[model samples]
Structure formats: C-alpha cells, structure tokens
Target: MSKKVYLVGAGPGDIELLTLKGMKLLNRADVVLYDALVNPEIFQFCKDDVIKVNVGKRKDHHLKKQEEINELIVEYAQKHETVVRLKGGTPFVFGRGYEEVRFIVKAGFEPVVVSGVSSTTSVLESFMIPSIDREFSDAYRTITGHDMKSFSEIVTQYHSRENLVIMMGIHNLKQIVFTLLEKGYPSTLPIAILSKGTCKDAQQVVSTLGEIEQKDSLFFEQMKQLTPAIIFVGQTLNATQELIAK
Candidate 1:
C-alpha cells in the first residue's frame, strides 16, 4: 500500500504550543522529517525505529532546495512509510507547506494537515501588541520582509501601511527598517520584534522605526543572538486598550 503523508505545523519553538492532533500523529509517525526551527523536544515523541531526517536551514547555511524536499517526501511515501513533515510555524505561512501538499497530491498520495498555534499570530500576543485593534488600527496584515524586497518597488509600496506583521524578518531587519522609512512610515511608529517566540528563552526588542539604527548596539544586539522571530508594526502597540489586561 502507498503510505499517506502528513504535513504538520509544529508551531514555533515550544512543544507545548503544538495542538493535540498534531502531537498524536507525530507520536505515530513512521518517519520524522523536520526543520531547524522546530522544537527539539519533538524528537522525544518518535519511536526508536523511526527515521529522522534534518531539512533544517540556518542563517547563511545552505538549504535543501524546495524541489529536493518535495521529492524526498514523495519518495518516502512511495516506499510504504508514513511520512510526517514537521514544520515550524504553519506549513504554508512562509514555511512552503503548501508546495509540499501540492507535490504529495500530484504524486497520487493524499496529504493531511494538522494545524498548530501560528507564531505569526502568537508573537504579537506574547509582546502585548494587538494584530488588529478596532479602536487604534484600521486593519492588521502579514507580509514577508524578505519576499517584499524581491520586488523592490512593491515592498516600498507596502511600507506606507501602518498595521502589519512580518514573519522571519529579523535577519533582514536593517533593510526592512530603511525601506519603510523611505516610504513614509512614521519615524516614531512603534515596532516590536520577538525572537524565539513561545520558547523559554524568548527575547523582544520594541522601539520606534527610526531608533532601530540609532540604538542598534543595545537591544537589537541581544536580539541577534537569538533565533526564530517575528516583527510587528503599527499604532496598535500604543493602543489604550490593554491586550494583556484582558
């Protein structure tokens, strides 16, 4: 029998953040495939006979190309093994989780998705910032700091908006700050970046858009030492309504 595949969201870096359904499938996986951003504790759930493969990509480290990863998933399932691809954050949210599903279905195997707490939404909650505050922000949106740069002009276009969340943005922190400034984002707009979100060693750097360069040596310096983060921008941070107080 051709085995079925599971494309699961492992959440950020905290195993506790994983959904019960995700945990259930992970525990029974015949093969465990994961990323550099996944919580290490996930390994404890798998059996000794299970095959564990690392598809993690670190800063500056070469990544397994997307096509290669897609092929690998199909190859394993073809051999009659239950393949589980555990990803950090949601698979499709900058995790390329959707592409994996497309490949699986094309290969004639059905793919099951198990959702977990998404860091895109969870990070702002951790920092006491609201994704959308009806009283303060007109709307809340998510955009990729790096992908936005690919278009150059399009990224500059997005910077004009006030309410936004950026996932996997810290590595390009300096560039994102410069682009938004040129596009008229207020110099004093409140911005927050949470590193290693939902994890025990999480750290956050909150400052005005302009001060990111002026104070790079202090708060931003420590943030660089951490991993797996998200950036949030808008007036919502300064909203009178206390998100945490609720």
Candidate 2:
C-alpha cells in the first residue's frame, strides 16, 4: 500500500473556522496527531474508532519531542490508510510543519498540505484590528516571540507603515515590549494582547508600549494566565480604536 500523510491546519480557536477540505479530511482520518492549540471540538468530525494522539507543547513544555513526533507520523502512516497531522493555525506558521514534511518525504511518503486560517491575522481581525489598513499600514510582519535572539535581530527598528503580529508572546511580553522601546518604537505606540481569539471567552488587552513598560508585576502575573495569546503592535490598532469610537 502506498503511504501518504496529510498535514492539516485547524485554524485559530473556532471550530467553525476550519476549512471545508480540512473538515472532510478529518472526517475520514484513521489516525490523527493534534497540537495543543487546536480546538478540541474539531475531533467530533472524526470517526468513533479513530486513533487520536495528543502531541502538544506549551510554554517550553513538550509532551512529545519533535523527533518523536516525526517518527510517529511515519509509523502511523505506514499502518493507517489515512493519517492526519492536525496543527493549530496554519501548519507552516511557527508550527514546525515544514520539518515534519521534510521527514515524511525523506521516509518516501507523499505529504499533502491543507491550508487553514492563521491566527496571526484572524485573531487581530476578531478584535477589529486590521493586520494592515490602507490608511495606516501597507504591510504586516509576522514573527514568533518564543525566540528572543531571532526577534531582536529581525525587529531592529520600528516602521510606522508596517504592523507586527507576534504569536506565542505572552510569556515574553515584558521583554518584547522593552525590545520595541529600545528599537526606537514610540513609547505611546499602540499595542494589544489578544487572547483566546474567536472563542466564547476571548479577551483583549489594549495598551501602549510605554504603558505596558510601566505595568506592575501583578499585571504580568495575570498575563501569564492568558496563554495562547498574540501580541499586535502598530498604528493600525489606533485606527481600529478611532473607527470604533466614531
């Protein structure tokens, strides 16, 4: 039997946001390996006897290492007719999906990619914040906040016409804010931390770089509880506020 693997994107947090093709594949999956941020309700579409594995990671804590996950994908693909690797947001967007694809291809199996909605932009839109507005920003940059070194290197300076959408940045919020300040981002530059976007309990914290810098330890402590959050910085946020106010 020919071995084949499907890498599916589960969208941000809303189960409804899942694409039609993704949902159809999930319904027929014989085995599924899902991530931490994927909506649990999505599994409802799968068959009752489907094998489901939780290979999720959170804040430096990994349930299964990357190498282990790669091995499992190949192992399951060899046995199952339909193998699905479900990931939160899009697979390639900070999901380490390309690495998995590389390993699967190396194992001589066909790897199919099914694109889904990414939280980097959808989360911002959920809060009425455009990733890029014609009047405010002409472009947007998406970066991961998990690595401070890469972040510092890429975000050396601030651009008023560009927006920054940072994922997995809740834990390093303070450092990210300080780095922006050091990189010449204005102290009053508008920023927002969007959490659990598209879900019923979604929350947002709107503030400025200077204000966030002055936030007390208690504020940060509270922020830690809001994991799986996205940090947005740019003038587009101000534009969102102005439109909402009027």
Candidate 3:
C-alpha cells in the first residue's frame, strides 16, 4: 500500500509558529524532507528514526529537479510509512508545493496540505508591518519575483490600490520595480523589502520602486545571495511605520 505525502508549512523562521497538526505529522513521519530555510529546531520533535533530507533550490542550483523530487515523493512513500515535505513559509508560496502536489498526485499518491503561519504575516508582524487594514488597504496579494512571465502575471492580475506582498524577489528586484512602475503602481508606491525575513539579523529596507537601489548599498550585495524575504507595496507600507515604533 502506498503511503501519503504531507506538504507541511514550517512557518516563518520560528518553530513555535508551526501548527500543532503539522508538528504531529513531523514527529511520526518516516521521511521528513525539508528546505534550507526551515528552522532546525522543528526537527527536535521528530523521532531519531525519522529520515531528514535537505533539498533547497537556490539561484542556479538545485539538489533535485521537479521531476526528481516528484519521483522521490512517490518512491519514499512506497517504502516508508509516511513522508513529510516540510518547507519554510507557506509551502505554496513560491516554494513549489503545488507543483510537488500535482506530480505526486499524478503518480497515484494523495498529498495532504497543512497550512501554517507564512512569512507574509510573521515577517511583517516582526517589523510590526500590517499587510492589510481597513483604512490603509482594501485587499492584499502575495506574488513571486522569479521570471519575467511571473512578474508580468502579477502586474496583470493586481493593478489597483491594494496591498501587495512579494516573495523570493531579491533576484528580480529591478525587473519587478520596472514592471510595477510601468503598470502604473505609482513611482512612490511605498515598498518594503524584508531580508532574511523573521530571522535574526533580519533587515528591512523601506523605499519606493525607484529608490530601492539608491537607498541601500547592501541591496546590491544582498542581490548576490539573499534569503527568503517578503516585499510589501502600497499604502500598507506607510501604515506600518507607527506600529514598528512600538
């Protein structure tokens, strides 16, 4: 009998933020596969017998491809009793959790989703930044800053006065800025990029699309090899100043 694949969200940097249901699965999972950004403390709950694998896809490098990972999910589940695919932030948020789910399902496996706290909330919460508020934003969206097509898709989908959250966007910051600006998101639309979100030494750069590079020298250095971060755009950026001071 084939076991199930559980895609669990490890939450934003903090192990305590993980959901009880997700943590329970981790403890019992036969194969506990995780990404690089996940907090190592979460693994303390798992038994010594559990198998842990690290396969984070960084810029121009990947331990395994989508097809390979899909195969691993099916392969592991068939042998092991349970398989847990742990990822930082929401598994679905730029983490390719959906792709894995699709692949495993196609391979005759049912993937269960356990939602946990995502960086869209915790990262901003750490800095006391709110993603959405009644007076500040009508709505908010989470998007990726990966490729041109992804960035274009975001601009096409979101073009109103709403809060926008971008994940894994450091690499394409310039393109993101140019695209959003061209789409009429306002030159001074107020943007905040949270680096190493929800972790120690976390840095928050608050600037507009045009001023992001100019405002910070580290921005260029960070663009080399930055960790997961959340980018906020719109009035939501301005509204967070008061809360951050508290």
Candidate 4:
C-alpha cells in the first residue's frame, strides 16, 4: 500500500466549524501537522496514538520555515500510511496549503484536499458584519495588509458599495486607514477590528477612519495587543448597526 498526504482545513477558531471530512481524516491520520491558529479542541478528533506536530507561524516567530514544512510533509508521508496537514481556514486562502501540495506531489505522492470553512467570511459573520449586504454593498474584497507598497499600488481607488476584508493587517491598521483616507475614502467611513474571532475570548472594536486618526498613539499600541485580527471596512456595517438599533 502506498502512503498519501492530505491537506485539511481546520476552519477558524471554532472546533465545531471543522468539516466532517477533515475530522474523519484527522481521526485516521498516522501523523498530523497543524498550525498555531487552529483550535486546540480539534485535536480531540485525532486518534490516541496519532503523532501530532505543530507547524504554526506568527508575525516574527515561525516554528518552521515554509521550506521546512514542505519537507516535513514529504518526510512524514514516506514513513506513515496517512499524513494530514491541518491548516487554519481554507487551505487555498493565504494558508500556503497549495505550496505543500506541490512539494508532496513532486516527492511522488498524491495529495488529498479537504475543504473547510474560511475565516474570511466566518470571522465577519461572527461579528454580525455582512460582507455583502445587497442593500449596502454589491461586492467585497479580501486582501492582505502585510505589504504596504503592493497594497497601495493594488487598491487604487475606493468604491462605495465594496466592502474590504483585510487579513494579517492588524499591525498596519493606522497606515491602512490613512491610505484609504488619502485615496478619498470618507473620514466617517465605518471600520471594525475583530480580534480572536470565534474564540471564547473574542473581542470587537467598532470605530471610524476619522475616530481612529484622532486617537493617540497609545490607542494603536493597545490595538497591537489584539494580534491575528481582521479589519472590516464598508457601509454594510452601518446597515448591520441600523438593524440592531431597530
């Protein structure tokens, strides 16, 4: 029998949000490589004898480099009958799951993919912010806030009916707001920071571009404590507010 590698999505912080397929694979996996953001509760699904490995990466701390992770997958597959690479959110959405798949295939093994709930939509939903409310927005754009130069180049203009869902951007919140403002976004435009969303200690802060700008530097410093957050901006949030008010 040939050994195989599986790329699984662990969903957001909610262990229950894990897909049935992903859970099944974890149970049968001989070895599991999971990320840091994946809910710890999901491990309960793994077999008692399963070998678990942590391969998560943070802003400045990485347990293993991407190259090392790819190599690990191949190494495990050769030694185990079933190997699972459990990632936070969907595998394809900035999780770098595809990169692992490429390496696995090149190493002469087929990879199986299991789809999981994505944080891009679920995290916003957890805060009652509709990514696209037909009444307020027609489309939503999800982008990375890690690179300022590329971000500034890509987002040339702001659209009133387009909501923005920024990932990995909590560190650049102030700069992102100012950049949007410089690009002609309204000073009063609604914005939200969803921190540790879907987790037991999840928190949310609702403010505006102008309000944030008016706050002291200490404000941003405090915001930094809420790492691994999502930045949501658009009029759709206003609609949600009105709905709650009524």
Candidate 5:
C-alpha cells in the first residue's frame, strides 16, 4: 500500500502490444492518467473500481498542459497507493515520459518505469521495412520531423548506409522532403510514410523524394489526414520494394 507512481508505455495502439509489466502495474494502480494515443481498451486491465483520467495532448489541442499533468501525477501518488501514467509508444520516445519522471523525482517520489514496444521499430517493421539490414544499412537515426529548423540542422549529411525514421512528421511531409532535397539528399531517395502503424487500419505510401515533390498541394493536403504516421527514408526501402515485387 506504499504510495508510488508508475510510468508505463502502452505501445502503439494495440492492446495486445502491451508488455506484461505494464499490464501488472495498470491492474495495481488506484488512479490512471492516460494519453490521447493510448488505446482506451487498456482500461480493461484495471479493476472496475479504478479511477481513470484522460490527459491526452494533440497538436493545436491540449486537454491538459505538461505542468498540469506532472502535478496530477504527484497529487495522485500522494493520495493513492498506486498511480499510473500511461503513454503511447515508448515513454521516452517522444512521449514526454521523461519529463514526468523528472518532476516526480523532484517531488520526492521515485517513479517506476515499465518499457513498452516503441512505435518507431514496431510500426515500421509491421510493414516489412527493416531499419537495419545487414547488406544495406549499418546505422539508423530516429528523429523528429515536427521541427523543420532543428531537423535540417541535425541531418546535415545523408549517407547511403544510414536510415532515417522520422516521427510526428506526416503534417510536415512536403517541407521535410524539400529540406532534404536542398540538403543534397538524392531526388530518388526512397521515402515511405506509414500511417496508424500497428493498427488494423494501418496504411502506407512509398515513393521517392522527387515523386512527392512533384505532386500538387492538394495531394499534400490529403496526406495531412494521416497524423500519427512515421516517415522513413533510406536505401533499405528499395529492398522492401524488391521483395514485394518478387
């Protein structure tokens, strides 16, 4: 009955993707604060008497601010025997789970972290795209496509052997492609955008950087409908094409 907060990863959007430890903590939690991307079906793991709060944040719409969320984690921990903050994807992988843990520590509580299947690897692999192939790639960079300025700054060079997996980038797809082209990435560089990855409704579009650039703005507008998508660019993508063609 000791008071504690558990930061758990809910995996992509699949209830089956949740890890054993994560499920155990969810069942033990007296209060659960979950994000927008987490599958609400996960609540089935908790006792019917548990208290659940939705603190999910979306672009241009935030149900609760970061400070508010951190405060709630601490507040719940102080009052409840066990509190859970469940996030989509891996907690540290762009989900701001680290920030929550830091605040929890500052509040004099040591938080327990439960790892979940990150969308970065699972989502892309679900479509048969290998982040690393023995013959094709040696290194892969997981980056954020949300900020064009920082993205251009960090990805200064494009090596054929390296792969780029960009998250939260579907909205800025055209800009990202243009920036890469300006930075000397080949116009023929393969690009694949996988939407709602790991879910039953998952969809993917594979094309070269130049092909996307030549499309009309209307085409880009249509793409904005797919938000929670990952953009992968590299030679390994070509291998996936070869396999599919065969």
Candidate 6:
C-alpha cells in the first residue's frame, strides 16, 4: 500500500471553521501532528485511539524541530494508514506546509493539502474590520513580523488606500511600530492588534503608530501573552468606527 499524509488546516483557532474534509480526515486519522495555534478542541474529532503529537512552536519554545516534524510525518505514514498533519490556518499561508510536503514526497509518500480559513482576513473581519473597502482601502498587504529586515524591505512606505495585515507581530510590536514610523507611515495612522482571534477570549487593542510607539514596556510585556495575533493598519479601520457611530 502506498503511504500517504494529509496536511490539514485547523483554521484560525475556531473549531467550527475547520473544513468538512479536514474534519473527516481527522475522524479517520490514525495519527495526528498538530500545531500550537490549532485549537485543542479540534482533536475531539479524532478517534479515541488516535495518536496525537504536539509539534507546535512558540516564540522561544519548540516542542519539535522542523526536521523532527518532517521525519515524524514520514515515519508515522509508514505505520499508519491515515496520518494527518494538522496546522493552524491554511497549510501554505506561513504554516510551513510546503516544506513538510516536500519532505514527505522525497520520502516516497503522497501529501494531500486541505486549505483552511486564514487568520489574516478572518481575524480582521471578526472585529468588524474590512481588509479592503472601496471607501478606504483598495488593496491589502499581508506580511510577517518575525523578521525586521524583511519587514522593512516590504513596507517601504505607507499608502492610505492599502491595508497591512501583520502576522506573528505581537512580540515585536514596539519595533514594528517604530519601523513604520521611520518609513514615512503617518504616526497617526490607525492600527489595531487582534489577538487570539476567533477564540472565546479573543481581544482587540486599537491604537495608532505614535500611540503604540509610546506605550510602556509593561504594555509590550503583556502583549507577549497574546501570541498568534495580527497587527492591522490602514485607513480602513475608520470605516469600523463610522459604522459603530451610526
């Protein structure tokens, strides 16, 4: 029998957001490797005897290295008829699903990708924020806040009509805010941090580049607890305010 692995997206920390196909695969999976951002409640779909492994990674902690995760997927595929690699959000959207797929294919196993709803858009929508609105924004840019150099290179300047959706940015919120300021982004530009999006305890912190830059270290420290958050900035945020006023 040919070995196969399913790369499934568990969605943005919401159990109901999981795709039907993903849920079906989880129900039949003999082994599952899930990420940190994935809701633990999602595992309820799996069989009672399923083998579940936590291969999640946080800011400074990793349960399993990428290499180990890759090898484990292949190893499990050899013994289990159904092995599922459950990830947060879509497999390819910053989930490192492509790398895992490549490794699995090299090991002679077939890899199947099941796309999930990405937090990039859904998180903003959850807070009544539109990523792209004709009245405010014409386009949106999604980027990672993990690397300062890459971030600076991409966000050369700010456009009022363009919205920015930043992932994994809570850690470097201070620096990110300063970078935007240095890059000619207006200090008064509206920005919002949507944390633990789609989860029950989800919260939103709204501010501006200047205000966030001036926030005390204590504020940033507290923000560290809110991982997997998105830093959204653009004029489109005003639209939400307008709707609320009416």
**Which ranges in model 3 have alpha carbons more than 4 Å from their true place?**
156-160, 213-218, 223-225, 244-246
* lDDT comparing candidate 3 with the true structure: 0.79
- Compared with the true structure, what per-residue lDDT tens digits does model 1 show for residues 161-215? 3587876667777777877887778888878877777778888767888888576
What ranking emerges by lDDT with the best candidate at the front?
A: 2, 6, 5, 4, 3, 1
lDDT of 2: 0.92
Candidate 4 TM-score versus the reference = 0.97
Off by over 4 Å in 5: none
State the C-alpha lDDT per candidate: 0.77, 0.92, 0.79, 0.91, 0.91, 0.91
TM-score of each: 0.87, 0.97, 0.87, 0.97, 0.97, 0.98
Q: List the residue pairs that clash in candidate 2.
A: none
Better of 2 and 5 by TM-score: 2
Tens-place lDDT digits, model 4, residues 102-186 = 8988999988889899999999988888898989999999999989897899888989999999999988988999999999999
lDDT of 6 at 140: 98
Task: Give the clashing residue pairs of candidate 5, or none.
Answer: none
In candidate 1, stretches whose alpha carbon ends up further than 4 angstroms from where it belongs are 155-161, 216-223, 240-246
lDDT of 6 by residue, 1-246 (tens): 457799998999889999999999999999999998889999899999999999999889999999999999999998889999999999999878999999999999889999999988888888899999999989999999999989999899878899999998888899999999998999989999899888899998888889988889999998887776899999999999899899
Q: Candidate 1: lDDT of 138? A: 66
Candidate 3 local lDDT, 1-246, one digit each (tens):
445789999999878789999989988998987887888989998999899988777767888777787788788888888899998877887678898988888888888999878887788888877777776877778777777786786477345558878877777787777788777777777888787776777887788877863546566566645556677788877778766567
For model 2, state the Cα shift of residue 44 in Å.
1.0
Residue 210 in candidate 1 has what lDDT? 84
| Model 4 stretches with alpha carbons more than 4 Å out | none
